[model samples]
Target: MVGEKRFRPDGRKAFREKEEFPMTETPLAARDRRATAAATARALGAALLVLLLTVAAAAAVSALTGCAAEEPTDDGDAAGVATSDADGAIVVASALCSEPYEQATSTNQIGFTVELLRLIGEKSGRGIQFTKAVNHKDAEQNITAGLPEDVAAKVAAGDAGLGASSITTADALEGVVFSDPYLHADFSVLTKMDTGYDDLASIQGDGIVVAVQGDPAIAAWVAENLPAAEVVTFDAGVDALMELSSERAQAAIVDEPRYLRYVQVKEPHLQAVETIASDKDYAFVVAAGNDELLATVNEALAALRADGSYDELCESWFGAAPERGTATRSAGEAVQDSTGA
Candidate 1:
């Protein structure tokens, strides 16, 4: 019955009927299925390799960019947030004075106060941003009158952190704090080499014009001590020295380091005559109530002193370390001592 032949009634031709065979795949079809599977696996492998290579490239780029961003900047501070934000920055106000201590031409603020603030920032993990004050007028005014709208007032109002310059302690700054004295300076007389006015007595005579910085205390001292001399006040030491150099004033009275640095060496036409007042102490002024910031600054100063950075700064600026046994007085105490109160 599986393979039988059947005839039609008409009898044209007989047809053979075969049994049905079970379904079996052909060799060509099997080869096609295997080739398709292999091609899919190759495509999947290529996709995974491309994904891994992309991730590796992204990681390498991130590592290189991170290293470049974390490098130290030229200002000696790590490059990061802008200091103007004040979120983690210490904003300092300083008045330009003598060279090497505070230079006008320095891009890095290569002065004593600038370097000191940088060191303090480094120790405290804060960044230093420097602002220029209107000179020592604020300190002088704070000494004479109550705190007017000056740098000290700015510090009191939280507009700035510290006032840096040759700021001394004063009795009138009731809401301000003074740091420990960094430099103990003496007030001295500067005169031309041919003036022949050696001492306060010799310089005090009729028609004698003496130039001094616009500190009321210094002006008062000159007025009280040199009664016979007329005092001319200028807002800056450079201006006062210029007055003496041009023969407009007979003598100029300024701090010792300034005289030694600006006049003695830079301006060779001038010479220091004698030391007048020897008790003035230079320090930074901060807001009174900010004890935490004050403590941080004091700690930094102590570290610098202990590590000899203070001495190095002194030598670089003053050409020698400050004398031993210098009094570390407050602004109020220094003002009282200066005024003999």
Candidate 2:
């Protein structure tokens, strides 16, 4: 029987003997599996966070860049894209609407600003357009009041355009850029022919009230200079002239061109005496940044003066050629009486 029962040598099972051994699990394997899972999750989270931060950073950069580039700068030199709040029209605004400078019926705006700008437009191959007021004082009021939104708006928005008016003093030169001096206006005090006041000093404190056309700029200067004179105000030059002629006011302050124009037609008894020549340098005021357009306008004005077109316009208005030999004439030189006193 021992020979028949052949058992395995050691711990063997072969239908005669059976042996079992213990299996010990490794702690390192379990730990390694858990660490791998954690690492994968962390990698995913970090990638997602990086994506979110990149997106946010891009958004912040976009926000920092503003819309200023899309709009025209305040200077009138913009030949590029124009701001489109209004229609795409280049509007030229002026202070004169009535006769001599401008009229509803008259086509020539020669002596005044409208014609000069119109000529500039014509030479530039662009039909210069216009928006007119009753007078320079009216235009100034419109500028201050913001009545016509587009013309005033361009100035406010700092676009490449300007309104036609005199840019005379340092204070007036603050907000707008001035063109080359196109004309000079003589300042004078108008009084009834019978009024004995000969000079500014004679009229001061003489109980002789002076009528001034309601131009705050000119009026302010007059007020500062002539402290003793009582100033009466009027809506327009005609009204001021009427006041002086009617003796409602003893005197009125007016420019020589307008005064001479008035004396030629209206009350001949009204005498405009030389108190002080306004010595005005009339210019176009463009949007502050448009130095290029200003330069262009100046260049064109110079050309017009050289070619005799400006002289022709002046001759048409004053019945004589421009004595200054240029479009600009100083008020004092143009209006001084023959006596020079």
Candidate 3:
């Protein structure tokens, strides 16, 4: 009895012997066992098919009905009805967190961003209340209410009315509304004039060093495009720019205005050889469907440009007037302006 072989309904041997001890007959040797195994395999295959179908169905449902994880906002707290024109002041959130920081967010409140908001507010006849960011990277999530779920609905649901600072109107933030471009982000590739590196391509060689602010964007760019080049990062754009020398880093990439305002004024020897991503637009963010307030802001921007205040402010801050033809153009407006149509 101890040595007698046993079998399960699944056609697997049920004997208590160690699997290595061996079986006198293969599981498929017996007719009944073979039939049972085939049936079991069929059943398992059917079950697996059903499971896959269920998972696919669930995925489809989620794709159709599920909203994306909320875009990173400045605040995590739930908001009330966001209104563009409430009796109280509208909250304009500002900040941009940098890399190489232990904190979750940082507040790099550039003065012009706030001042520009104030100007827009004054022009729009709305009382703008400034809300600083706990972290600079924290977008106006508090006001955005996480997008495509409808930004205006959330804004009208809460007091987080607008997002300012150097907020780029990225495609990822598609559902969110953006006003006409007030500023254009032209990242300049700068090098020491003495090096004779007159363009970005001059230093695209092995062992050539490039510097950038601690953001991964530029570092990743160098890694992908300039595989032979080495990249260095710094906490500030100045630190990165400082790396540029004939003996050291061959190039540095930073916001053009930043280099123009802070570095170029003092270090006249450095030159911007080329601009990168000049088409990037910096615009005010509002909730989608908040048309009146958005139009008001856009009109205010146009007025600012028309009255020469925009160029004046740019010159006062960045030391040069913005490229007028580029900034403030909406999508179709650029073409119209270009053709004079």
Candidate 4:
């Protein structure tokens, strides 16, 4: 009866019933197909949510790790010059003072300070660039009482990492820090052979002219120590020496190294007559509160000293290793003598 033709109440001829098929081959109803499609979509949506969450977590972890790796540790590198780049290059300020210590020969800078700085760079694996903060003509013209203000200002402003113009620690101003002394020298008097002045005392008298660098301290010292002698100031030691050579001034006061280089070696007729002050210590000067830079510089200096590089530099520049522990006057005494206090 299920497979036979069935007739409706008003039908002339009813359609025959279709044959049934296996369960696997049976077509699903519209409602059942809709339910199956919805379930598959939900499963796919859950998988996609998991994948997005995993990717987000991985990105967060990577960021945190990168930040940790970039953090600097405490191995004597704490604070640095604000102007320095990531490669650790630094700018050094200097003045063209004298030969064998600091000088501008053509476009290249070659001198004791230049070589020493290069050695430091090699040892520390850092790059160094030098700039002349104090012009030779200007430094020669205006000598200040304390540390040179322009140099101090540059370092304070982060324009320079250090000042290396044969600067003495005694010349340091407020908010400036000086490294340990790498070279020591004395103030001396230079005169022509015919001047017949054997010492500083002999050259002192009324109408006797003395030429000196444009350093207020040095000028003050001359005024206080030699009250009877007339003082003439020049822009630099070389200029002062020139005054003596030209016979414009009977005597010249300069540092020991300059006396040895310019008078003894260059001008054989000039002679160093007397030692005025013997305790000047030449060092690199940095802005105050830059402890990290100071530490690194000291470390490099100590290494140079230990490895005999410092001695080599001294010999190359001065023809011998510099004498250490020499007796000299205190800073106060020196300043007082210069200021006539």
On lDDT, the leading prediction is: 4
Off by over 4 Å in 1: 1-87, 95-110, 132-149, 322-341
How does model 1 fare in lDDT?
A: 0.65
Error of 2 at 38 (Å): 85
On lDDT, who's better, 1 or 2?
Answer: 1
TM-score of 3: 0.55
Give the per-residue lDDT digits (tens) of candidate 1, residues 209-270: 98997776577778777788878887666778788888889988776666555642467667
Which of candidates 2 and 4 reaches a greater lDDT? 4
Please state the error at residue 111 of candidate 4 in Å. 2.2
Residue range 105-180, candidate 3, lDDT tens digits: 2443346666676677787777665443432234654432122223333343443566655556653454357878
Count of backbone clashes, every candidate in sequence:
3, 6, 16, 3
Candidates, ranked, TM-score: 4, 1, 3, 2
Q: Who is ahead in TM-score, 2 or 3?
A: 3
As for candidate 4, its clashing pairs are 140-235, 220-338, 221-338
Which residues of candidate 4, in runs, are more than 4 Å off?
Answer: 1-80, 83-87, 97-100, 134-147, 172-174, 321-341
lDDT of each: 0.65, 0.56, 0.59, 0.68
- Judging by lDDT, tell me the better candidate of 2 and 3: 3
Instruction: Give the lowest summed-lDDT range of ten residues in model 3.
Output: 327-336
lDDT (Cα, 0-100) at 239 in candidate 4: 80
Q: Give the top-scoring candidate (TM-score).
A: 4
